[model samples]
Target chain A: MPLAATLSSVPVVIDEEKCIAHKGCTVCVDVCPLDVLAIDMLKGKAFMKYDECWYCMPCETDCPTDAVRVSIPYLLR
Target chain B: MKTVEWSVDILVVGGGTAGPMAAVKAKERNPQLKVMLLEKANVKRSGAISMGMDGLNNAVVPGFATPEQYVKEITTANDGVVNQATVYAYAQHSYRTIQELDRWGVKFEKDETGDYAMRKVHHIGTYVLPMPEGHHMKKVLYRQLKQKRVEVTNRVIATRVLLDENGAAAGVMGFDCRSGDFIVIRAKAVILCCGAAGRLGLPTSGYLFGTYENPTNAGDGYAMAYHAGAELENLECYQINPLIKDYNGPSCAYVTGPFGGYTANNKGERFIECDYWSGQMMMEFYNELQSGNGPVFLKMNHLAEETIATIENILHTNERPSRGRFHEGRGTDYREKMVEMHISEIGFCSGHSASGVWVNEKGETSVKGLYAAGDMAAVPHNYMLGAFTYGWFCGENAADYIAETYPAGAKPVIDQTQIDLERARVEAPLLRTDGLPPAQVEYKLRRLVNDYLQPPKVTRKMEIGLERIQQVRADMEHMVAGNPHELMRAMEVYHIADCAEMAARASLFRKESRWGLYHYRVDYPQRNDAEWFVHCHVRKGADGEMEHLKRAVEPYIVELDDTEKSAYDRLRVKREPAIA
Candidate 1:
């Protein structure tokens, strides 16, 4: 399997309760290097494509609430 | 994940009063060293000296009192529960911090006698002291930073400290506010100077009080340190300012100076005369209001006259004031401004808690490479009044330690995954679909804590408050932020929930109450010095649960003079007469 395809199998969960509406954070929008994830302000959350997410946990660690949870494929028992 | 790298000798987070001084002092100690500062808010706006307050505490003036006297005063106020060694260190080095600010061109107010004017405010007993001129202090510090060529990254929030293989602080991980990019700063030493969390559902007026100024001080440093295995002290001891200005408008505290005013409830009864310690009286008033005697208004003798005069003055002069037409010469302009500024209003005053991450005499936490300063780090017996002093000591010590341990040219390793993780975490809020509005969550959280978890209300309905907060937390799980701004607001409310839970948990753990105003327990009416005289430590466990640890109180050895001793005794006796 390709590296991008392997990475895309990881699960990304967002905790909506922790999101504060400050238009400053666009990590998901910018860090997707692949531009797979975009911020939807109307929903006040991030939208990701199942095939597009690279399984990078940048969103999980940078979140102030530790709200984003990432589970790597195969690593999740 | 892509990696980005930068190196510095010293990294100071939250460049308020102490961060700048720490950076300046580090450069002063060794000019060849590189010092960097990162602040979440605009560096010009937060921290101890941020508001242009015209005075610092009395650690500067010569011959008025010694550092020993200052330590004695603090320990007395804290009821001997303070860490005496840390208190001494802060008091002793306070003069040096003030002098350093002055050397850096920070100006202070002068007296008619040509010496630095001193005030007897906020000190134990009758000790008078010199303070920096408030507004000019900021200008001086900023100019010094510019002159020193210190690298400052403003509007950047530090999310976590970088831990090396040895579990020592290697540097910090943060997100840039503007670009939404992750910036990993590698430094030999990291100083956590993030100010205390203030935005937690504390009842604050709608006006332009300082509490509303910096919403970013959500105890980030404290939470980060706790998660990293640092001990936090006295998390239950929250400071309540007695007088908040107008609920409808902006105002500062009027109780700081000698204001000739009386506090009355809705029944027009003078409640404050019963106890000089206004914190107690205010809490009692809240209880009365909860018991159905409230919607109380503080009738300021000066304010009433000032309002009438301002109305007449505006009417006579044809100069339309922004607020409204004012009367001429009917009242004191100072009084009118006081009301306009929201200085005399009474509400639940919450900003920086005097409690936080526990540190030793050297400002070292349990973690080796980690150090805390400002409102974020917890030092016993030090109140917000002494924040600059404590910040100075902690910052200076951290800088010196970093300089001695690691010289220039020390390469720090950058983790690309860590950067990626951090960025994703910060932006998660912006990805939610459907849930509660950020503002509504904020309102509900604040209302819950204010109504139930506040000291006065805490005693009556703590269990109910806890249940409500838990339910609220569950409900919060359904909250969604549609945009980056909304996500930031969501993060703020989430932070508040974390803080409120910690505070309520701490309050519930300590069954017996001590420290008259700080932890007031109506049920456990007396100060059980024998059983309850220990500092409470809160930390997150391996299971991600908050574990509580009780450490013995450090003995205060400072001897007071006969007169001072008498005064101290009198103040303690006067604190809680109703319960006694």
Candidate 2:
């Protein structure tokens, strides 16, 4: 079987400046129920790795630096 | 991947609402015993009440309601198909559960006298107890788990329940979401608190994760119990709520109804007298939505400013807090506009309706050494408080059972074949580099659920649904995952498929339409009480194929009068025929 990647806008947005992933912050990643957020080791920042988000928002509320913003997934919005 | 094994006295699957309570209460009962609470997500933010809840949907306060009254109400709401024992048991323990949570720093709305300020939301009872500051409910539960010294494991998806030689539940098997490490926990007993099969249906938004219940609850407990030979009851009576259109979270009539808000049709007229989420209420909501007065709305724009603000404060801060955000994105304001509402996709949830693993008053399932509670357990309209009350029951009961049956040094002899099969099934997707994506497969499967299984169901469509589901089951072989997280989703696909099959089979077996919209078959439009009044049960037969049977509805301890029995039938407000 062949596979192709599709591009779509993700619901959770992380502010790189305030993400503090370089300082070993994973609060957003740890709190997401869907486990959709991941820390990009290369960029040293938290990012939405998967589009599967419930938008339940522990990621945004629990973020220490207030770096995470959970927009209603585009389809829902 | 590697395998990590542990031995414990009790293993509680799912750390959401009931699992944590079960673990804590079990440890409290037998502090010497080793009890572990396993969660697919962090316990701090897991399950339906992950973000805390606005209020208890069914709180049996002393002055407001009695256990008998509560039992009668639930029996009527469930269309008279309840095992009154389980519901009565929850009602009896309801107050104590509330008091315990209150003692543990959980707050409830109170009168000037400091009694539980119960509000009337149901048709015949006052059960709604608001939790204005209930956002910290998880933190409160987490505190209790730590204080009780219950062991907690995070990110491990429990795929199957391991059975002992005696056909008893002995342990659990699965893998961690992040590490792909196979986890095997051997225990004297297991309590399943896995929540509703929320992901069983695809939302109108076309988003796979968008569902009324927390998307994490992929009906893992239901599938595990069925595979373990435990009977599941009334699965045909599916869970379908009136949620915010597109967003797929609740329109929250329970919260708004107490403050004079209601579900209205497009003409902004109240069609149903009550906003309680019963099958009957959903049927009326569905009818109004399909009629000329189409597209129901949660009417709060007519409320006072202070009342609206108070409602907003509670709604925005608690369960699915993102609800407020969704409303804002749509430019919906409680004062300016009525929140648009639509009937949600079908799923199995005993919390709202009676559809789950069968359990007695003691929280013991047909399979010994196995207990279930919370939304997954068949306690009709159990909701949040029932989950906690039943969690306490399962925890204490399982602890007692462990003390009596399994000796201190006793170890369950689990079949190696079970573990081997589960490992192969769990790890297959991770091994493939190129194949189907779990999300796409899940979307396709759930869309089939919406098409064939969504209620106002037809016999031919459901039969076709069974065929299509079998096709999807075969396609699951080609599902490939890129990482452990994707592996978790892939594994959930199997559970969802199992639930889908159970939903279809159970729907077919019942034959008659009951539970209003939950099991409204177009072919069998009339409710046939003579043959189908019994609780319809589904399980894995000796031949390893899905089996369906009817269990007698346990004799009702609190009988309803003829008038009361037909109370829910008159929910549709008689609109005086307009002047022609």
Candidate 3:
């Protein structure tokens, strides 16, 4: 069986301009209970690595630059 | 991956509401003891109250309600199958826990006179205490743990409790979710506070993680207890709540009910006189949804502008804060349209309903040296406060048990064979590349759970559910994980499978319908107190099969009158009163 990449509108979005992950801040990634967010090593910004989210909002609330926005997951919305 | 070994005086698994309290209290009892708080996620934000709570659902504050009254209320609420001693113990210590949290900077809604502004939500007592600014609850607990110097280890998912030759809890074994490194922790005792089996049933949204309880709580502790020879009580009495339809958060009757918002039908008429969460209340809600006036809702459209704003301010800030955003996305405003509500999927949770690892008044499970608290422990309607109080009990009692049973510098002598077996089981998913995805396996298992095990349960369907669950157990061997995170989910699939089997088998064993809608059986449609009134406990039998037992309900300390015994049965409004 072959597995292919699936597309999803990720709930946690990081504004690259405001995200300070390039400055070595991992607050959002560390605080997410689901461990969904990760620091993009190439882009030097935070991104939702996995589509699995509880919409519980620790990532959005703890972001220092106010760059993280957690929208309700599309399936739920 | 290399194996990591840790030895401590006491190991408290899960840093949720109860686990933190258990660790902190154990340390307070003896500051020299090395107490470790192991968590599946970061301790700062974990467990059921990960996002903080809105109110204490069962706060038995003095002057408002006594321990005796609270015991009687829970007894009647759980349909008289409660161990009154456990509920009474919580009641006696409720105020002390409140004061401790208060001293630690937690806020509560109080009147101008500095009295706890208690609200009447239950059928018989005033227990609801609102926490308007409760979003910082975890921060407060984290600060306490830090101050106490409790050892904290995050991202380690403990799968099984290690047992000694005498069947006593020696420690625990699992692998770290992020690194895939096997972990072995040896201790004199182990406390299991892993929250509800929230992932047992997939949400109606078809989203796997959108469960009412925090998605991380995959019934890990319940499975751990059973595998360690601990007995689980009331496995058939499932937790079914009235939640916001697709979002699966509480429409929060406790918060809105006090402000005059209520559960209403399609015509916007009150059907249930009380909005408190009880099996009987859910039964009425289910009946209303099934009737011509289908799609029950949280009706707040009739409330005054000021009241709605106040309610929104609190509801949007605590507990499931994203609830407001979900409503906004759907264009459903409290002042404009009613919030749609539906009955939640079934799972085992003693916090809301009575289905969990059985524990006595001291928070000790049948297995020696193993303690359980919080949502997973079998204490009915315990809610958040009960978790804290029971955590205090488990922490203090386990500390005493360690002092009495094990000498200082007593180290656990664990069997290497047991550790090797669990490691192979945990690592098998990652070793296979061509195998089923954990999510797909979980989705199918939970779908089957809904189809055959969701209640008004039929005997034949449940038996079929048992067979299907066993099939999933077989498929579990082939469930593959691409990474450690997926491995964590794969392990959770195993836990959910165990719970699904427990739910089906226990539901079949009861032989009678009880707890209103919770354990309603289609075949055994009547409540038979003559033969089925005892607590139904399930555990791993000596033959390695799931075994069922009928433990007689502990004799009641506070007896109830005939009228009080049937209080929850009368939740439906006598007349359909509609707002003009």
Candidate 4:
């Protein structure tokens, strides 16, 4: 199994109240260097694309609000 | 611990005009010698050429004037504060530097008479000729460096200079931006042509903004040299630009030509018209803004509806005579301009701080084996024109000295402990639990420095500002960084704190105001030239406390004719009225 698949099974939780619209958290947009999490301005938060997530944690680390939470699978836990 | 070691005869810290020329001179002196250049940013994007300004102030080609007349003009413009020896050296070598640039394949804009055009642009002193294709100058220098087989390491930030037991420069350690790898380069001689530290809390000058493109210039080389025990001169002297269109934006001044703009208070009254001196004009504007007439905008009178039409017509017709297209392209549409065309900030002709590291005639710092050139070194009384000229002289002299004193093929040991400490320091922000995000920290830092820590404000609330900055520095200590990019941001904050502290210390030490632009104390409004004409020097003590020392101004030897001195004095008296 690919690392993406193994990591995809984990839950991705985002706190919506903290997003500042800085656009620094767009980890999954087209032309993005990393495609871990796609940002939807309409949704006012980031949507996890589990299959393409590089597990780079750029979105989590760069989030100004500390709103991003990434949980790995049971073996890592 | 693993280490990577490299060796070179001469290591140039900056790849700007001075750096490349210095390396080339070293190679010319010895063909078999090895030269290495390290740049914090890309070489093409360094110095005055990066912003496409061809040449700074120089009296190269005679234009209805002689070199002696040009020297008097410079001294008069500088208000008799220029170092005569440095100015004379520049006057003599100005033609040679220009000729070298021509040989390097750089082109200059010519007049209709088929001769190179010269403008009376005031940079160093009175006249500075513009280079139309100065960007090509950077490219030509880079190509020459390649031809000389000089090794260049781009995107490498030189953290510190390594000194041997005798306090001589042995090598340098830097971190690579792309790979996030640390590099240790051993060199017998090091030339610091790294330019001025831009991170100090001051308004952006055209030269500074034109170089960095962004606000990331945190005075890295200044801090590095100061830490290595170099005597820093004139830390309080900062240049203020009268024509910053937007205070919060990335854009800088646009060329408004000879017809200058007017600065107004919030009440829409022209304030600068009351004062003729450029420094005084800026000081009055700053005072107005502080006294609740703020968010002030510079208005240009020439940018009227007629000007917009002229510009639009020029752009539409692609006319050569109309410089309007240049203005409009920079978003300077007269019709839809936010302010009336009557009010515009004067662009292009502005002053930079005429102070830096104190160096003698040979550009040698107090520390042996470590030399400073360009804006980073202080040659008393010299401005940008002298800076460029002294840059060449120092670069050539340092290169030759290195070639003679230190031979090629010498390798030095790497300090692994120092490398680990630097890495840990950079990574500390990442490990923090965090009181604030990096962006928030950056915002707070900029606001505190710009609003409260600047010159006009420093007079009123300096003690409070210093205390606030101390607290802010403590807050920055808690800033977290998780990635390499974030680590760089954290390091920027550290560097800014270092520069801000030095500036504040320098500000506190100078009891009386000497230079109108620098050391502006609201409490002490008078220029106490009798008591405070001495140069201010700041150095960090063993306990990390800043030590302040006052030294007498170095005397200048000027062999000026009676007519020249009389004309110079007359111009000095008239300077106040001309700017007013």
Candidate 5:
């Protein structure tokens, strides 16, 4: 059952300049229903770790620093 | 490895439409009780109405329709295998629930005279109530929750309902996605309002997340209820909606149908008399698409500009708002083009059709301290309005049960052995850094569901589906989760696999075709009301095998004459002869 890392353009993106995750804000990651976004321990920024995105907008709407933007997945668009 | 525990009078799992109302009503019922509303996501927006609903699909406004009428309609729409008692309870309280939401700052479409503006979408009665500004519904509910002082826990995914020695619900178990801490909450009464088993089927688009449901509802509630020894009814009557082709969201016939938009075939002719979403209507939709007509569309081009604009405004702003962008990308405009429609991959939803955790009129599941409502609860056509009403029922009822079953120096017992095993199961994926990816396992599982259990179900295919699902169950042991985010998905794969197995089992248990396309077994091609009219229920047995039972359809309180009984079967309007 060996698995390989699959890479693709994630639908949710965070603007690091606006992202305040370094300041202990995990709003986007916390509010996302699918839990696709996670805090990057190295950079202390939130990033989409899973490609499965419902595009339900809770992540974008609840982001306090206005750091998140949701794009329709490239495959569907 | 860290463990957190909570003890409360009532624990409401899920913060979606029903869970919010349940929390609010429970608090309002008995202010002394400790009510905790647990959510996998934030309560501000979650579950089926994360973006809020476009309209109340089943509103029984007093002047527009009576409780009896709404009950009868649901009885027929579900193809007759409904517990009228459960639907009747919702009907009796439908308008009151609407008024309560209205007082809480939720809006519904109103006529010029200030009365509720109701529209007819069903075959016989008027029920649909549009809320063009319904996007703020969750905000309204969240405010109520805050005002009522319901403890809200966000980001905790509940995996199981802990059973007492007597088999009643005692507590629940799961972990927090943020810190990977094990969570075990104990309660006197537990209400499960987790929405549909929506992620059971892979969308035809081949994209994992483009599901008709919010996708967060991976049927965790259904699996938990079954494991708790609660009966789940009518699993074979799968929810196969007519949705936007590539986007996999609803084409929203309910929103546009009242505005003169109808489901049309390739020639752009109306096929069904009613725009309501019943299995029979969906059967016609499936047929037309497969016929020479090939593809179907939501026809609105014939409508006036004003009507189309109103429809677009409501459709683009509420429910699945990304739909507008999907339409834009496809170059689809309601003013000139018909929106393409397709049969969605199947799943179980009591909200849309009759397949969910079985509950009586009081919203109580067979498990004594356990109650269920909303899409997960087995009440036919229990849409957003029904969810709210049933939530109210469950809240007050669970509150009463809590007071009655109050423990004096008694505590909810936990099986430490079970807890250790669950912790091991949740942590295994994280332990193995390079095993089968959660997404791949989920994709393969749902694809297998689509391949083996999609409607027009054949016995051999379903049996094969059961075998493949067992393999998925075994493959789950080798699943990999790089972080808590992926762990959430890995756990969701378990729920989806359980749904796949139970779906196949339920489809096979019923020996005759019913609900049109929902249970149209190829081998058993005709509807056999005599032998298969009873509701098929499944639960985990004492032997740890899936057990099936037959529950008789409660005698209808609202008697339908023979013509009314078959009203849904006549959805196709008669076409007149053409003159030479």
Candidate 6:
């Protein structure tokens, strides 16, 4: 299949300054139900890689630094 | 990818509510046993109550409610088609389960005098017990699992239950959702707690992941058990909940009804006498929505400011916590505007409705060496507490089954051919680099379900739905995954299709309109008790065909009087004098 780009806004927003992925923390990525969060290796921070999210927030609540925030998806809002 | 194979004394599939309980109790029953709890997501946060529950929907506390009364209420709510033995068993043990969780640090609402703050939510009985700080529910269960030393394996999507030549459950086969490695495990006994088929119907929002159920539970247990030759009961008694419109979460009359909130219509007047969830109640809700006074709402504006604040605190903090954000985005203020309500898409769940793989009071299914409990198991109206109590029973009963017939000499036999077949089936999407996306296929499948299988069900529409489903079944071969994540969705599509066919077949077989909005067939629009009072069980026949057969509903141990039997049917409250 050819590569294609789609317009979407991810629900999970991570603060790179507070995200400890650079120090080897994957808590947000591990707890996500949809597995949509991935580490952006270049920035050494976690980011939402996919648009699919249930918004049932373990990622936000369980984060050590309170770096993660989940908003209702734009389509749903 | 290489296949990982292992053997255990017992294997518990699903680490959600009941699976962890089953695994813990199995080890507690006998210390010298190898038990495994397999989960598709992290066990710490998975299943229906992943974030946590707001309250216990049905708690039969001793002073507040009794076993007989609880049984009687469920029988009436289910329209008298209940197996009283199964329900009565849950009722009898319900308090013990509550106490056990309480001791393990799960919070429940209590009065100043230290008694349980039991409240009235159901039509006739007071069963709803508030758990305002119940957010740590999963963490408490995780503690018990670790204390019992039960083995936990996360991210393995169980695809099939392997059976021996004699047709008894021998083991299970699947693949890791993250690694794409095939997994096979042999066990003396297998317990499935894979929750409701929440993804069977497409949401109105058109979002694939926005489902009433934890979208991860795509009816995997129902499909795997059916393929293992287990009989599933009452597939037509679908779970159709009344949820917040578009947001698809509960307005939760269960929590706020005790605090003075009620379900109202466009005129801001009360309709139903009770806020309890039943097929009859859902039917009334549907009728009100369609009757020119269409589009219902949850009325809370009349309550005192303090009461409204308390209601918002719990509703926004637990269960589907993101509900608060959704309300904010819609600019819904309980102090001013009534929150809109709508009927949810259909699915199968014994926890809410009576549709699941059949199990007896002892938690044994038709097939030997197989046990099931929780939402997937067919015990009428067995909510969260019921799941815990039944999980306890299954764990203990399975321990006995394994102790009697196991590694001594009666070892479970493994069929290599079945494992190889499942490996190829799971890997098919990954192997095909170019094909239809799993998400698109699932979206199409669920949309067809909504078109034909949603309530006020029409015979012609259901028949057409089956035809579309069959065409989709053929297209399963063309599903290709972009990566391991997509592969998980690909596997889920197969399970969703299995549930859709079961729903269609069972709906067509009943031939009578029952369960109100759940199986409201337009062709046969009346309850035919003389012909359809029996439970319809569906399973795979010898020739690879879907077979439907009727079984007699067990004689009620606590019989209902005429008034009690018709309680649910009369949900619509009458206005004094005349409304015309």
DockQ of each: 0.02, 0.84, 0.82, 0.03, 0.62, 0.69
Put down candidate 4 lDDT per residue, B1-580, tens digits, no spaces. 1245687777888876567777777677666667788876566545433433434445466553455656565555344555565556666676667667677786664689956666543432334454544435556887888888888876667777877666677767766544556677877778877765654443332121221212334566677777777778777765444433322121112222322434455555554432223343455555565677664554543476665454344222211111232344456554544332111111111125455776666667777778777667765334334544665666567667765665554444445676577656655665665455554565566556666656653565777667778888888877775554455556666666766777777777787664454557777767676877677788767786778888875575555455553332221212235464
Question: Which regions of candidate 5 are displaced past 4 Å?
Answer: A15-26, A39-46, A62-67, B407-409, B577-580
Score every model by TM-score.
0.72, 0.99, 0.99, 0.72, 0.97, 0.98
Question: Proportion of native contacts found in each model?
Answer: 0.00, 0.84, 0.77, 0.00, 0.66, 0.59
Residues B374-449 of candidate 2 have per-residue lDDT tens digits of 9999998999999999999999999999989977677778888888888888889989888899988998999999
**Cα error of candidate 5 at position B72, Å:** 0.9
Candidate 2 scores a C-alpha RMSD against the true structure in Å of: 1.0
Give the per-residue Cα lDDT of candidate 1 at B523.
79
State the TM-score of the second chain for every model: 0.80, 0.99, 0.99, 0.79, 0.98, 0.99
User: How many residue pairs clash in all the candidates, one count each?
Assistant: 68, 0, 0, 14, 0, 0
Ranked by DockQ, the better of candidates 2 and 4 is: 2
lDDT string for model 6 (B87-167, tens) is 999999999899999999999999999999999999899999999998899999999999999999988889999888778
Candidate 2 residues lying further than 4 Å off, grouped into runs, are: none
Better lDDT candidate (5, 6): 6
Q: Which pairs of residues collide in model 5?
A: none
Q: What 10-residue stretch in candidate 1 chain A is worst by lDDT?
A: A1-10
On residues B1-580, what C-alpha lDDT tens digit does candidate 5 reach at each position?
Answer: 6888888888999999999999999999999989999999888778899888889889988888999998889888877888888888889899899999999999998989999999898899999898999989889998999999999999899999887777788878998987888898988889999999999998888888888898989999999999888999999999989988878888888888877788899999988898788889888888889999869999999999998888888888888887887888788888889988898889889899888999999999999899999999999989899899999999999998877786565655666777677778777888896678888889999999999999889999999889988988888888888777678889999999889989999999999988889888999999998887898999999999999999887888999988888999988768898998
Point out where model 1 deviates above 4 Å.
Answer: A1-77, B1-5, B122-124, B127-133, B204-213, B247-353, B380-385, B407-421, B457-460, B470-483, B560-580
**What value does the interface RMSD of model 4 take?**
19.8
When 2 and 3 are scored with lDDT, the better candidate is 3
Off by over 4 Å in 6: A1-4, B407-409, B578-580
lDDT, residue A33, model 4 = 19
